[model samples]
Target: MPRSDSRTRRSRTRSRRGVPLRKSLMVRLLATSVLIAVCSIAATAWLAATTTSHALRQEQGQVLARDAQVYDALLGYAATHRSWDAVAPDVASLAKRTGRRIVLTTPQRRTLADSAAADHAALPAAVSAVVNPLAVDSSLTGGTGATPIDPRAVGPYRLTAAERTALAASARSITGCLLKLGEPSQISYAPSGRPRVTTESLTAAAPVIPDVCGGQSRILTRPTPTEAAALHQLEGLVNPCLRRQGMSPIRIGLDYIGPQSIETLYAPMDAGRITEGCVEDGRREQLAPYVAPSALLFVTGVPGADTTGFALTGANAVRIVEVAALVLTVTVAAAVLMSTRLIRPLRTLTEAAQRPDQARNRVPVSTDDEIGSLAVAFNDLSARRERLEDQRKAMVRDVAHELRTPLSNIRGWLEAVEDGVAVADRPLTSRLLREALLLQHIIDDLRDVAADDAHTFRLHTERVRAAEVVEWVCAAHRDAARTARVALTWSAEGDPELTADALRLRQAVGNLLSNAVRHTPPGGSVEVRTSVRDRSVLIEVADTGSGISDEELPHVFDLFWRSEKSRSRLTGGSGLGLAIVRQLTEAHGGRVTVSSTLGAGSLFTLHLPSAAAPPLRRDPAGAAKDRRER
Candidate 1:
């Protein structure tokens, strides 16, 4: 059971692994493109949300300040207007200042004023802040450190000349104290002439006094007159908001005081439910004339999420999906197109390859790529195979033709003597014997060709002088040349040596010599000569006989091919001698070439590589000149 279960599990695993790959190339490519696009789009969306969310979270203080400025502007506009008819310029001005699209709508969601008409549909109907100067919104009241204060206005705490001078003396004293304690300090002055002891590291310093600075570590200096006037106006607005909230009036110092002292009075206490909206409005009313407002403000980039964080809206998500679909479509189209082009040629090649042997099928080369080259090579191979098959059939016919004549002559003579048609005389017996000898010669030549073809022929290689081989061949064929009434002569030069099978080399040369002698007419001359050229030994057999024609010369080395078309064996020979010579020469890693001119005779040259380095021969005249110069 366990073994069967394991086998089943393996099969299931294999099936699972193979399921995805069974799809077509178009499906696979489209699926892969869609997968990648989805992943990329998702990753991009996630990364965008994460980065923007973290950045917005870090700039919470800046966001709160911008919100406060916008609210203040809106609140001022609402406080002055009986209706929103003249609010367009205000909305446009705020939008330009804040780099955001701004819109004003009534509580019933009716559009009143808009900075960008096109963006109106896209914008959420949720109000960012209530446009009531009498109301306070908690969203607009808090800041990063204390409440958001205008840095340019110092309020009642603005420093006088005497106060600045006093603060400078104190700063110098603090610097001395810091130096004594091995801390860095510098006296930095505000534009309002308030002096301060500052340090680069002190920006991160806590509010508590450090003993190193003589226990007088303070960051704030006295405020300017502008700040003092602003503070007076803010205190008056706060009392009215407190009164409306049913809270007792609060008193602020007419004398110069730091902002920290003033914030401590109002920030901790919530007067009443009415003041929840009232306090925020009072703060905005005090600072409304000072700060610039933004054009638009809101945050939402994630779907089904809050407006304050990164949220993807419906419209944006749809656009992304459409783009991904387009990418997938293009990818699938390209894959299908390329695969189709590739498969067409492959199909043609397969059909051609599967053709029957007799059909001799070939594919057209239509391109210059790898597939086209493959088609060309296949066609060439087919042509060569067809030619070889034809040659094989012709050779069989020729072999049969050669053997028939000799056998027929021998059989005819013997039957004549036996039947009493002719007497078995000496001349008749000699002719029969000659016919038998001719048959044996033909058989021997066929056997050599067969051995060479079957790779059973071998050579015994040795160093041989070209001149010696030529001399021996000429001597062996001298009698035949005499009998043919042809003059035979030979010469040697350079004493060139070759590594070869001596018997085969001699036989190859003898065939050429015999052919030359046989073909030469009466008084015609046959010459054998040896020389060295191009680091090879050359043996030339030139005959002043009936030379081969240009059209017939190329077929000279083909088996059973002869210049004479007649099937007369006595005149044309067995037609295997030159073919055997070619086989033997090739076995020795050499080649034989012939050149002929009509009525001018022929030259056959055997080219063989030198077996050993030869001694250099120098002219005696050149040697003498060198010696005289020395």
Candidate 2:
């Protein structure tokens, strides 16, 4: 095998080993998408868990508050009623409001009122609380370090309507007096219909009592007629207990402000405690019959039943897993779609690039992305390669055709002279020398073209006049134009100067003039013109000849190209003149352009960089004569 082939085979083998999954674009994209999806799901789950925990805690607080409300309502109901006959409606209302099952039963477990009685549900094993007006649950009632008996259990102390109205008027009088004394106060009636004077800033330990309002307080704080009667009965019940405990009998009031009320009695601490105990016992005994019997209260369906804290249930767990799986699947599928779209164009480019015929192999451009731009650039490169290939083949044929005729003629003439069929005379020698010079001319042109192509063509640049170059080229072609019966003329707009090789400039313009004279018919005019334009000098050669066709105009300056493809070498010339003109013009950092129309004349323009003109010398005698004439 060839060394290059073996190396290529080894390289192909290495490439076929393939990339690892981690390095592949598709695999990386898939993994990245999955990672993003998992992160998103995890973040969403964390937020949901946090939010749900907060909401459940708030709900737990609401449940406890509602439970307290239910207990307070039932305690009030039992404090007023002697039985549970109308208590079923209240239980149902509490259950509906709190979204819980409330059940009330006697001490003997006999059902009193059950909100869920219609469903016949079994009661919970534990009781929430005990409902008793004589001994209330202070935790449920929000009372602390006070009597267990509910304050609402007034019983015989409940004020009559007539006494309540009379006491309300007294309460108003006290409130008005406090207001006049610059003390803002409001009137509040307790469950017993006894009005109390208080202010927003009032605390139980420190009551607001102005000097002028002290008498009003005394009047309002005094028991009403109905309360007085109840107080006398309560005192009668309490004094006996106090006497038995060796404590002095005390006058009982309708309300107890604080421990200060007991301090006023000058009673010892033990005596004060015993007095409070005795008062509670006597009050319970007095109000026992007017309230409901003690019952066992059962509340069910409260939130946060499992005391181990929050946890996701089986269904919720399954749903979360399903959602995570769906997200991952969707993300991976989308990644695959995007990666395929991205890699497909690259694959097409690879396949097209690998084809042997690059000039013909083209990839389709479907998107306006980077891949599309790459494909467009590749297509342009292919087109340029194709044009160069055509030009290469045509150059080979034209060179062969151009050299073959002269060689054949020279060979035939030498053979004839050697065979004694022709003389080696001056005319024949002249013909032979002309043919040899033509060959040398063609070789020289080819050498120049090769040097330019290799970037070895050097220019000895200097300031030269464009008009002088045009005149030289026109003068050289004047004899040929006259012999062909063609009129040659030359003109200049100004003495335009340019920085270039004078010899190369003459050669370029000479080529154009020669082409113009040869192509112009007899009595046709060939014109050479020079003018300065902007920072460049324009050398134009316009000829009234058989103009080039639109299709052939573009390739006029192409190597070895001729408008008359079938014309002989003698008639059409070597076809390298215009091409050399272009190469020489471009070597000078300039350009040559040709424009022609069918049946009309052709124009060739050389655009070269302009140079500053030298200063003109003034003639002293001519200046004196011109001044005298003025």
> Candidate 1, which segments miss by more than 4 Å at Cα?
1-318, 358-360, 613-630
TM-score of 2: 0.55
Q: Candidate 2, after superposition: displacement of residue 371 in Å?
A: 0.9
- The alpha-carbon deviation from the true structure for residue 21 of candidate 2, after best TM-score superposition, in angstroms, is 32
> Taking the tens digit of each residue's C-alpha lDDT, what string does model 1 give over 320-417?
57756765666677667767866898898888778838556777766544555566667655655666777878888998898898898888988998
Per-residue lDDT for 299-391 in model 2, tens only?
887343454355565655666677667667777787788879888999998898888475477677665545555666666555546656777
Local distance difference test scores for all models: 0.66, 0.75
Worst 10 residues of 2 by lDDT: 258-267
By TM-score, the best candidate is 2
| TM-scores of all candidate predictions against the true structure | 0.53, 0.55
